[model samples]
Target chain A: MPTAIEQELRPVAPSKLSLRHVSKIFRGQSGETLAIDDISLDVSEGEFVCLAGPSGCGKSTILNLIAGLEELTSGEALLDGAPITGPGRDRMVMFQEAALFPWLDALGNVLFGLKLKPNLNNAERREVARFYLRLVGLEKQENANIHELSGGMRQRVALARSLAPNPRILLMDEPFSALDTLTRETLYRDLQSIFSKRRKTIVFVTHNIREAVCLGDRIVLLSSHPGRVREIFTVNLPRPRDINDAAVATFAHQITETLTQYLETPATKEAVL
Target chain B: MKRNLLTLLTFAAVLAALEVAGRNGAWDTRVLPLPSEVAAYIADAFTDGARRDQLPAAVTANATAATLGTATSTTAASLWTAFAGSTLTEALLVTLKRLVSGYLIGFLAGIPLGLLTARFNFFRETFGLVALGMQGLPSVCWVPLALIWFRPTENAILFVVVMGTVWSLMLATEHGVRTVPPLYVRAARTMGSRGLHLWWRVLLPAALPAVIGGMKQSWAFAWRSLMAAEIYVTILTGCGLGWLLHNGREVLRMDQVMGVMLIIVIVGLTADRILFAPAENRIRARWGLDKN
Candidate 1:
């Protein structure tokens, strides 16, 4: 471990987050269950990668591992050439539920994420928090209570909160899954805009193949039950791509078909639904 | 507003009916005094300090105490003075003071105790189990134990009141902290919040609605336990409202008894409305549990 003074003096390099043969096995009351198999993937700096598969695919578990919210059973998950043993400021995870504190207002929730930046004074932090809120199109709802906000609005605030800290890597576990179609579409556009504006490595998890196609620069498909990397699809689409665009739909369809075919094989045959 | 007026009108009509029934001897006035007479008795208790001849002997004797003593006065001199006489107003104030003090101390102390219960296994097995088991017993059961421990001093009443409050508050806090959704903690921790920051900033606020609920219930428990203690340990605890009620019963002053009962109900309602109502409403609104 580097000394505190050495850490401060050394300019931190933005190396890619690398997962080398990472595996996670959960010990429950019933027995030990393997959640993830040996999965080696490197998310480059400022890359938008989506982990896409069915429910039991351990896509979320992958995000948790990357965020250092879960311990690896085997192999190493590295950030900036350092092993990730636990959660830190550089890695922020946004859950499916907005998870915004009901006790706080919209800006208050964003300001809470800003608490990680100890050097920033109250006024500067407020300014930074407000900027992110405006980025997510919630500039006017700064003082609005979390409970007062609609479900879509709440998610927007959660997005703002996660982005406010300006983490090096954003690990999102199906943050928009619970939202309606229209809201999710709007959020996809907003998220794309934010991702481009604030360049950061993002590992997004989603079951929606279309959502993965619309958002991710590269989509990593994983097989269900002891999730392992199935295939990689690189989206060669233009910036700010629309989810309803024909090109996006075609890519989504292709990925879904390939995934279904692999899962339907006799040796590993399993029901998709 | 319309509903409130309807309730007020209904309450007033019931009081008026009771007044007429007692006046006509239909309800036996001696057994249960008219509402107007009870109100008059309460008024007399307040203003009849100078006119010794007209006032009830008990009222004059009690009210004749030099002045209202402080709530925490456990010194021998204060005890002697309190034993001499304590008025209806003094009794009410003393009870209120004990309820507020005992509950505050217990509630504050229980927050950490309850945190222990929810956070660690050893505490959960030992202290949490004790709190859970003790909660099942009625609060009045503490009065005898407190009397044996501290005698008829103010400590005995306060001890009972604290006993009534602490366990309930502890259990409530434990439940609140334990039931906080795991997502909130995960979100905060992933953002680099841990240890005490995690406890106060994330965990405590998340557990607040339940803690507020504990405060409300703890207030009621404290009030009840204080009353029970006052009834038995009546020597120098400044003759609390419970003592006044018991005294009225002994003297067959039905009006005084009902008057004290009315004050007790008023105090309960006032605490609920003034202290808890707005707080509960605000929390409900902020938490998205409110109807409108």
Candidate 2:
């Protein structure tokens, strides 16, 4: 841990968000089930960090906790040393479902996000919305209804909506997992470029190993059965890294080996004891 | 277009069959008049000199006698002139006024209550369930209560109309608000929309299709209730189409009775086509719920 003064003086800080000993337990009629057990991680500013794990790993739960969409059972999630209270304009989320309001057109949906900015007048808000629509390659489909757009286009509109607010942190939970392989590949390309240009502090959650390796600066691997941080791998690969690249494959292979080790070893069965 | 043509063709065929039946006395002419004669009667009812010639003095005497002192004691010619001329139009206008006012009052009260009931558990368990129960009760069942409360006045008719409609509107609104996807609400909240703003932007738009559907149903209920109140209650208000339909039957003028029935059917169809259908189609189209 660095002192407050030291943290301020540092040219490039290590963390934009810090989670300390966070745990989540869900209570049901059957009894209590520990979803996450004392997980801690730091995500730096302008860094794309992926919380990658198998199903039931509480990866999505962690994203929700950081989003302030859910209350933590214990511990804290801090944004710039301040505890996240609730959903705010400072942190925008793109859900797995595009979740665009069907009643609004693409431009209207993006403009809705711009409503968070009190400074912009109607005209200025519209201009900002149009700019984001263009950025997401949806300039032509601004007036199109959600059902009229392709699944990929709907996600693009959702991306534009999330970006229009210019939130400091973007939380995405398996946003592209529903799209086809080709559509997901195209999105990966666009997302990388967008990340480069916008430099937003993004926390992406995914179960795909290659997706995590392709987009994240640092990947935090979580193991299931009371999800705990199994490992953290920093990808030293350059920007615009392809999912099919050999370097990504090497890193993915290494992460998979560790994950396999955890699955095979009975020593880690200390989980109950 | 082809479907509409088919509908028109079927209607024309029915009218032709009715004309044949009426000419050959297949059934008593008094039982169901010739469709052509009913159409002609309706047309003549609107024309001044033509209606005066067509309305017989014997029919007028019979109308006044059947209801006794309840029918105003004007001379046959004067009564026919008044009934066919200004009275018919005046009746339509008065009925329209009552329907619109009652429907509007129900709409104004029901929508907010529904939204509130859907959002709050207390409201849902109380007013929401009560409203659903009220909808199951027949619209005419409120007529007796309305008559006792307001007596023989315009307010009585208005009260019945409101009672007939408000519960359905409330239930529709509650259902609409309740069924709005949680995804949209969550998404809106994350975008910094809270409280009333959240309801206005996300919840209202998401619930609009169902709300409009409810409004259409309320209008139908209000219209039906207005007709029933006008016919049953001896109110000291202006006569409406229902009064005319009652009078037409009393005089044993089957053609006149059928003409009024045609008008009622036409008015209802016109309102549905002009007001509700286009609005529903527009909502469906904009929301991408329109498959076509």
Candidate 3:
């Protein structure tokens, strides 16, 4: 991963979106099950926050609530000041699967977002789409079909599509979990640079501790089985922070240890309590 | 291209063997015409225009029936009347009308029903199994009931066509909707698409290839049913290719029977090759669904 630092870059002022006592329950033939339990967190604008946990920890469930893909059974998820009722154009999501429309080429996928913005003419939509595609270092791959692109390239296209709409907040659900380690690291660096440049508010979800440490300005770790935020860690590490840096290593170790301890805790402990 | 050529070669070899067997008295030549004789008969039918004269009567009747049927059912005047210049034109127009109208009605009803059954749990539970069960019923079985329901009118034929084609389309659409990757829906929802917007933008496009495949299957069904309906039920108005085939059989003119049969096969093949093949190819290619 290549990292570059250039000072004098203006920082985007923070805006906060908060969740208050949010709970989600899913009903099935098996019975009603709690997916998330009284999860509450606040995310500031232009801050890269990662929700890290084990598989089935409802990390994704929380992100979905924020994006309004799922409604909270109890309590509230608020964006800015208003309670989220459903998905809005202001909050976009990127998934582990690129989910690029196969029929559309790379540029077409980006343009699909821009065209949905309302009242943008053909030429303007084209120009805006091109700008974002170029931003993602995919200028030459504009006409390439989804299948023609590599996994990393497809994710880049997905990122460009998500960003092209210029949403107030970006929600990513294990976005790089599908990519190889090397590709994921490279994407992490590129994504960090893009985030710095755009300063868009982002809430990323992942199970990987190293990934969360490398990318998040703040990491929110959730405990599994009726997911609840276990701890929130702030990483004040400066820009171009090295993965090999002792501080980053220590932070990763601390988060992983905490997560492991949470995972190992017995379900019977709750009954005993 | 290579496969098509090989297939043609194989077909020719089989026909040659049959011709040689008939000529050598290995089989009765009277019951089965030699390949050369059939080819010659086909050539004469086209060049001499003997079969062409009989074509007019069949085409004229089918067109008249289709026009009357369309007029009675809907206010929209039939396009068949406009194209009824020659026997060939009339036959082509009537068949085309039946195909378009049947497919259109099937698509309009099937897609929504498919989507509904696919999306809503209640609808899926209630109707999905029923729809799948109905698909197993052969379209030809509908002819007698359709005739009775519409009283052997042009409406009866249209109904048969619609019934024959609709199930495949419905099944295809349902399958398409069910197979749409959940990730796409999540992604679309994240981008603020919901309800009709979600269906139009995400669900419809994702389900399109399957729906199209269903349409092709529906067309084949409609075509087959139309022919069968014409053979059994006397529509009393329309002149269909099936009527021509029946007439040939009635007159005991094997040459005419063979000629009409050739026309039917040629037209069906042409439509499949020219219209549906290109559209399907383009879609498959775009979606990366094609293996070849």
True contacts kept of each: 0.83, 0.74, 0.60
Which residue pairs show collisions in model 3? A15-A45, B61-B238, B61-B239, B62-B238, B62-B239
After superposition on all CA atoms, how large is the RMSD of candidate 3? Answer: 8.1
Task: Tell me the tens digit of each residue's lDDT in model 2 across B1-292.
Answer: 9999999999999889989977998988887888877766665454332233456522331222123232245577766654555434556777889888999999998999899898999999999888989888777788888878888889988888888889999889889988999989989988999999999998988999999999999889888888888888766567677877787777777777787778878888898999899989988899877576
lDDT value, residue B175 of candidate 3: 92
Candidate 1 segments whose C-alpha is farther than 4 A from its true place: A1-15, A265-273, B50-86
The 10 consecutive residues of candidate 1 chain A with the worst lDDT sum are A4-13
The TM-score measured for candidate 2 stands at 0.89
Tens digit per residue, CA lDDT, model 3, A71-151: 899998888889999887778789889999987789988877666666566777787778779988999999987887899
DockQ each: 0.73, 0.64, 0.54
Could you tell me how far off, in angstroms, the CA of residue B38 lies in candidate 2 after the best superposition? 1.7
Stronger candidate by TM-score (1 vs 3): 1
TM for every model, in the order presented, reads: 0.90, 0.89, 0.85
Clashing pairs in 2: none
i-RMSD values for every candidate model: 1.1, 0.9, 1.4
DockQ of 3: 0.54
Model 2 per-residue lDDT at B177:
89
Q: List the candidates ranked by DockQ, beginning with the highest.
A: 1, 2, 3
- Winning candidate number (DockQ): 1
Clashes of each: 0, 0, 5
Ranking by lDDT: 1, 2, 3
